[model samples]
Target chain A: MDKKISVKVCLGTTCFVMGSSNLQELIETVPAKYGDRVEVSGVPCLGLCSIDWEFSKAPYVKVDDEVIKEATVEKVLKAIDEKLNK
Target chain B: MAMNTSTPKQTSHLKREILVRLIKAYLSDDFAENTRLIPYDMRPKGSEVPYRCCIHSERAILRDRAIAGLGFSIEETEDSTLLSELANKAEKRDVPEQQPLTVLTTACKGCVPSRVYVTDLCQGCVARPCVNTCKFGAISIQNGKSVIDPAKCKNCGMCVQVCPYQAIQKIIVPCESACPVGAIAKDENGHAKIDFEKCISCGKCASACPFGAVHEKSQIIDVLKNIKAGKKVIAMIAPAMIGQLPCTAQQLKEAIMKLGFADVYEVAQGADITTKNEAEEFEERLMKGAEFMTTSCCAGYNELVDRHIPEMKPFRSDTKTPMYYTAEIVKKEHPDAVTVFFSPCVAKKREALNNPNTDYVLNYEEVGAWFIALGIQVTECEGKEFKTESSAEGRNFCVTGGVAKAVQTLLPEDLPTHPVVIDGLTKQSVRDLKKYAKNGVCDLGNLIEIMACTGGCLGGNSTVNAMKPALKQVTSYVNSSKSIKEQVSGTEQVKQ
Candidate 1:
């Protein structure tokens, strides 16, 4: 089965400042791990920061429509794992 | 903007988040009211207090952060003071504080006092080298395990060096360990406190704290208020611009202009002036039989001399900084314009306050916040070409060995100028400088260049990029620019 999982890493100011810069590594690692099964790209802003403004779980990333808050390499990779397995 | 330190700490991210939010609030409709809502907005009623123990404690820390952001003294402010009131006061503030750093008392971890510890690896050997090596009897064998008495231990770390098993280790407070001047320490409450009298304003402690507690009193409100009032705010961008945003210099210029800056002048132009004058001064000093002279561009180094090593005053160069010369040129040309310098560290903020030509200072972090607040992408900006381009030497001033090399290139072939670079200031380097000053001669080299940050300005506390990438970008800029030797000769030919 050729599964298509699209991951959009939020590069917005809030996300970037909230340690999303570290997640940029996932842009490379995701493709290396999942091969053609996943497509990774950096998006400007998820616009979820203001929506989640009260408790800024900034640096959000979307893995196949699933928003990952307080994102990390491990968290992003785990999300990719669940989606791939699903 | 996001930074890419080899080990990017969460504290830096937390600090940036607060700055971005504060800038967003300031740009919003109701500055005072909105600024007050920051902590509540960030840590609303049911948020998981990720950092601190409780939501209330987290909010207290955020409140203190807001106080620092509004350019107020965190130590001086009463706990009862509301953020809304401070915002109003900040809006009307005419001048910034002289001290550049403020500690968030609630956020400081109040780390256990640094002491020599005997780890589990300790064999409790019969030689008892550790006990013997310790000048102070702080270590003793207890139940076949080495034990250290906190009160008796001087934290000298001699025992750590002598341990054969290497089981002994010294635990240090990051802020206290990073400070070269011994300016910051734990107070009665165990919260970090800075002795401003001894602080070199290097911002080492500000960047060192893991809790992101130390804050720079920002004049962002002052700069924004002027820009909002239709003042002609001209940005004097430092040589580190290329190392900041991912964009061409021309494009970065356009992006700065997009954010209400009437114009942008590369501080490198001022650095060129600094280079020429400093070269002349060095030659003059060398010819006068002086043994050596140090470069005077690093603001942190200048402050270190003023506060801690006054004896080195004579050997230090008296030339003004690049920001100074840049602001001078801007004022000379546009007398009515308000000058704002884009700096990479906190020392420049203190430096700008002293210079009449400079009106305000913004770190790379603040400028990044401003860009975010305005939703401006530098990479997408239309490139604006500069009328007069700077020499490679001027552009590379932010790099270690840049100033020394720039000066060395300008001297006559027979001048015998040997340049030595002090990569970064530390307790050892500070002691060496004092010794050099006391002896009135340096055997290492006749010309010494000392940069406070390890990799020069690119490694500054507030820089958004990592060392390798920043250096790569800056090197590209330097390679494309004309060399200083040719530029200097061209200018002299024109004058003749």
Candidate 2:
């Protein structure tokens, strides 16, 4: 059985207000593109913005163990491909 | 303020970040001092200059953004004045200034004046449809290329539409084009300037500008100062708030209280009164042989009627807005309480400025920033029921057809209302309304629901969430609430 990659899209206030509201399409689009190989879900804040508080690079998404900063639809998909090949 | 319901842009992100930073600084121990560091902190001395020509230019625009965030008019603000001085002034100001929006000259792209011109694609067809379509003698074929005389052109765009090759194009200044009324135009500097007399405070210009140059002078510091003074600060939340955050309305109520609000009144509770009064007014108007009566809850639409379309006066319902009624009730209950209206758009800021009862207007974005500043996760907050619950229809006043539907439900039997919702008034729709008023008859419908922002109040400039989720959240919240009919009859039964 192929390992299913987990993706968590941050819907936290900071992230949503930043730009994750734009990446919401990926929740549906990722599932259709990669099928059962990847699982995508909108989660609450990952607490990543607080870690680097000086100047926030918000709207972060998590692909498996990797935390993608300033996440976009294309960025998440690319990160997923990198993992699948690995 | 990012008003686009279709997609939230990067400019929206930048705007939110500035607000968040400003609020954080305001909440800090040294508000005036920390506020000074906002532009520098956001863009450090040696940081990467991602947006503009240089780091200095980016910081200049950010400084202007902070000034707007501090609730001062950018156009009137001098470049020499420091941000700390503005912060101090914002804290001391008795009332907000004129013009809800201010143009950030530093950020303005100064888009070339919007005009019709013959593009390179013009084949200079012998058909001469371009010349024939030109009513102002603006188009002439010269050197085998169709040229449009800018001086003579009225920019009616008829030639652009009639062109066979589709070569004729209208280059639009986004902010200028977005205005339903021709309120914003370029000065000799080629930057945008708003005419206050013609402006309606619809915030269309703010949302339309990709440059994010148009800014709503925020009233955040005023609300915060009052809160800090240990005054009885009451929050009158708008109906559109149900869709803004990831929480139930009840949860939001609790979350808001955590922000130090003495009590939070659901504006929906007041919307119940508006719904009833508008229904009574509509019925009376119809009985008096009036062809149609438009809903008057939208502040932007009211501004249009006041300034641009006086003809719409008789047709417009005389009922006060839900915010007005709600603020009145809040004042009556707590005469000494500092009343702050939590709204979805800048139009309400203008509306609040006119009303004596409304002390200040805080938009959804500011509220979201406040939540972030205080680290209050609305989704995690325990739900606390509102003391006065609003009916489903009253709660639905945020959407386009809500007001008309509320009125129609009351007159469902005898005078079945034919509702015609005017979603997002545009140049064409504004003209249509004028015609309806001039004729004193509307064949389209007997009830007109005019919302200035497309998709109603939820699609306001200050809203954070996208359209679909916001709609879904609001719909679920409405479905759980009681109906207006049930509430009205319940009151009658009690009175009897």
Candidate 3:
């Protein structure tokens, strides 16, 4: 019951306008399972637009300190699942 | 409508309204040739016309100066007083009228000839060096006196430099030369004056002037008015604003909230919505064989259309930019909420005015003033209210490929697609867009997303932070968020 995770999403224009902006909102509405651990906020521009090769590869975020380059809710759940298991 | 015979004064008022409308039409391009024939009633009538004191009305000496600066001729008559009244709309007005640069036109006898004021310091010491240096053959020794010919001499400073007496006079200043818009020029007393029309408000001349003659008008008082009213005020910030100050985003949000904004919303949130909408729009347009399309988000690009490429108007989308959309949503939810967009670009000011919902657009430089007036120390505003946007795709509106990235995220995984993102829309970039739009000739993609600014929003003309670091900060922010790392970030994603 002591599970709380800090989820920082780049709300910079590049991130927010892409899908991450919506993703940050989505995180707040996420089912009770991972909702409480997700602390979402918008930061300034981060240089991910440089490394982003594919459109699908972006609008990214991080859990704790690990970078999740591809922004997909399933990938986030996977990462969170691994952490919970550990 | 018939006028009552007893109300002669009311009829004159009606005529004034009609005259104002005619003047407006005359100043517009739509009536360039047919202005004389166009009736005044059709034009915006009455006190609706913005007015200010005629620049030349103050003095006859500066009349030509204003005319030359405005690139228009002025006809002065006994009715010039009425003309000034019309120009100023002093009697009846709603919006702030444009105050024309006040010039002493009555005193100016047109442009003064450079030779008229030549000093008598010609030593006449028989060296004849001054006469020899004259390229125009204007300088000569007449009756043992060095004289300059008014007709033959150019305003070139050669005569002034050669004279041992150092009597040559030049009215021009270095700051005036540096101004690309011709905004700065010498006043009646040879002091500097700024013409806001030609000025892009770039602040270049302000820095160039050794005398510090120019500074931007501050709107801190207006911002404070909204705060004091206790109406909900929000700061919708641009994405490139990251790392601008030493404080964290949370700290900054806290500081802004303390300054009296009921909430702090990220403009990135709007970008997310735009990305979602634009990506779909592009997919549909491309598949429907709309061969060439341009991004409509950039105000400069929109201006280019209105000024240079009116033919491409059909290609432009009606969808508003992210900032406008975000402000619209905020106003919709909170009708009383005054939205102030914090952007790096001055064009955003123009855009904000055009946007129906946005109340104000403050450049990053104004943020310091806003904080100072509120007595809020940004660094000391501990903790954050946690203002966040929708998704990582939404957050991508800041950089060059942001739109494309959002589109890609929205695309169904199994769809075979060649989506191309055209970054940094220069003239060359448009050529590239045409090449990609070619059917079967270019395999780049049917779907293309274009951004006019280099490096995208981060590279906007108004941002305070450099694009490189801002981009990095965005990336780091994205990498740190939890929901974007998961697959179900969107409601649509959940259904999928």
- The numbered model that scores best in TM-score is 2
How would you class the docking of model 1?
A: acceptable
Per-residue C-alpha lDDT of model 2 across residues B1-496, encoded as one tens digit per residue: 5436546566777777888888888888888888888889988878999899998888889999988898888888889999989888888987887667888976776478788878899887889898997889978889998998889999899988988899989988888888999999877777999999999999988888888888898888888888889999999999998888877888988999999999999999888888888888888888898899999999999999999889989999998899999999999999999999988888999999889999999888788878777777777888888889889998999988988898887774868578999999799999998999899988899899999999999888878777777888899989998898888788852110
In candidate 3 chain B, where is summed lDDT lowest over 10 consecutive residues? B2-11
TM-score of 1: 0.91
In angstroms, the error of model 2 at B351 is 1.1
Of 2 and 3, which scores higher on lDDT?
2
Docking class of 3: incorrect
Candidate 1's C-alpha runs over 4 A off are A1-68, A73-86, B1-6, B493-496
DockQ scores of all models, one per candidate: 0.28, 0.51, 0.01
**lDDT (tens digit, per residue) of candidate 3 on B48-130:** 33122432232222222222122122332232333233322311322211321232223223333224335666567677776
Query: What is the docking quality class of candidate 2?
Result: medium
- The best-first sequence of candidates by lDDT reads 2, 1, 3
lDDT of 2 at B268: 91
In the range B1-496, model 1's lDDT, one tens digit per residue, is 4222334777766666677778888888888888888888878899888877899988888889889888988999999999999999998989888898998877776475566788999998999998898788888899998999988988899989989999999988778888999999887777889999999899988888877778888888999999999999999999986776556799988988999999999999888888888888899998999999999999999999999888899899888888888898899899999999999999998898799999999888788877766667666678999867899999999998998988887888899898999988889999999999999999999999999988889878887765665788899999999998888767762210
Worst 10-residue lDDT window, candidate 1 chain B: B1-10
Candidate achieving the largest DockQ: 2
Off by over 4 Å in 3: A1-86, B1-218, B372-375, B412-453, B482-489, B492-496
